[model samples]
Target: MTDPLALRHEHAFDIRINFDKRWSTGPVYGGASIGYTSIGEGSTVEGPMLTGTLVDYSGADWPVVRADGVVELNAHYMIRAEDGALIYIRNLGYVHRPLRTKGQGPDEEPDVPAYFRCTPYFKAPEDGPHAWLNRTVIVGVGQRQPKVTAEDPPDHSLFRYYAIR
Candidate 1:
């Protein structure tokens, strides 16, 4: 038993999911994919990374809801960089609801503010300048947006990622 790993981090980038679409396959029990967990269609992301902008999105989000009202989300997507480099990202995280009491239901959490956090894994070109993304440990903080007016969508959110050093 030796010393524990020292933790240090820096802000990496942020992904703004401006437009979102979703449909659930229904939650299945006793499996990795489970109920009422909505699947996100290819939502668009607009952000800069390593001086490049993420231009395209192609993938889906697989989510599972636990009895305790926690949402496990696995988002797998491919993004095209402005420089023509394609990068793959998989963000696995959870949306935490208010702790439920005995006999309470998941809907009871609707009034409580939710907490969302996730760790993102990346796959980038080995020899590319941004190749460092392949080995860095990253964590993301999520901020959800509720519809403000008639023109605003409810599915929008921004996930800011940070690289742990």
Candidate 2:
């Protein structure tokens, strides 16, 4: 069996931000952003595109109001293939929170925190050549929300090609 990791294309999509919250905020502090992009299939390719941001907010102190420490998420989705033709899929997003440590002794080192704790934002139909350009929202501590804009259309020139030996 071929390895899925190997079969996958490298950076088939180009994610650029018009303005990133991280740029203004200090490096260590957490923030959110919105992004836009077009999804395309290279040379008759067909499959759903899974896109989203991976966030790390463990370093921040917990919120006093909410029981949760901090919320990290990827508002993303999938596109379904239709009638062997390319279609423009609407962009959809969702929010997720990372799992936190429970009652543990201070002496013990907190277990290595998981990067993405929430469930995946899955777009159904899982196959297609669709274009979905929507504003993705990522929220972090202190109710910080950032917006990301897509500067350039994605280039799929170097997509992976496979053939029977």
Candidate 3:
């Protein structure tokens, strides 16, 4: 018997992103994000890893800061490939989770549930060494950590992504 679950274990690389405080007048969760992305997957044969910037926005049902459920996010990226090549990525996905607490001891409140999952499509220059990424499909799993506070709404959010091949 073939184990379908085992077949899905195609491991790729992981990504860690940091945002520079989101600004929006529309609403709390209604805004765009422009930040830096680092290659958390470590080094390969290449001299050094590439870094890039990201532009992302929330969908209609955004600002779900207080809501406990799934929220949608759309993003566009321009990244430098490992070989100093350029690659663009488009993402369509959602984060399903709840708010969090700094800590949860035996007597403390329960921890908030948070998880990020998305599908990213890559586009590479036809003549670049990373052109192969143009045809590869990638799925990402991440964790969301929204700032915890009393007066401050969810302003800062961080995510860590793991690629699935």
Candidate 4:
């Protein structure tokens, strides 16, 4: 028998935000984010992701609502090396944050909170050149930096992603 762990390797990925649009309904804050990924090492797979976040602010003080968060992420990837083969990914996770304000103001700063971690499930064509992702389990770690400005439709949270071995 062979060691299964010995055959697996960890790869890191860099995520850059394209945009995030956030809104609030009563005490619930929710938003959608779109971004791209830069794969690590020699992988030619790169793509965009759309994520949705919901923050509950009913238990905090006025103005500055601090609470736990949950998010849903959906990604579509293209393999540049394999003539642009497509891959799909889905991720769901929780966010841990400190007491922070939502928007920027004269006396308030943007919420720069803690990191969020998630497990990503990949789906790829079995016959595709990069089909190995379909059978692999990947863990993702992310950092959040929420931005608020005076402009209309200010940029929201920015996140970076790293894949765990």
In TM-score terms, which candidate is top?
Answer: 1
lDDT of 4 by residue, 8-66 (tens): 53553443333332333344443433333222222222333222221111011112123
Per-candidate local distance difference test: 0.69, 0.27, 0.48, 0.42
TM-score of 4: 0.46
Candidate order (lDDT) = 1, 3, 4, 2
Indicate the residue-level lDDT of 53 in model 1: 40
Could you estimate the TM-score for every candidate? Answer: 0.73, 0.25, 0.52, 0.46
When summed lDDT is taken over every stretch of 10 residues in candidate 4, the lowest stretch is 54-63
Question: Cα RMSD (Å) per model?
Answer: 4.9, 13.7, 8.7, 11.6
Q: Write the per-residue lDDT of candidate 2 for residues 1-165, one digit (tens) a residue.
A: 887556332222222112111211222324433232222232232223433221211111111112243333323322223343322222222223434367766676665453322221222333443222222221111112233356543332122211211
lDDT for residue 137 in candidate 1, whole number 0-100? 88
Model 1 lDDT tens row, 1-165 = 634687887877777654445555554665334522232443444444554444333666667766567788787777666577888888899888556567767667655566899998889999977798899989999977766898976566678888888
The model with the greater TM-score, 2 or 3, is 3
Show the colliding residue pairs in model 1: 27-34, 27-35, 27-36, 28-34
Q: Give the C-alpha lDDT of model 4.
A: 0.42
Candidate 3: count the clashes. 0
Give the CA lDDT, 0 to 100, for residue 104 in model 4.
55
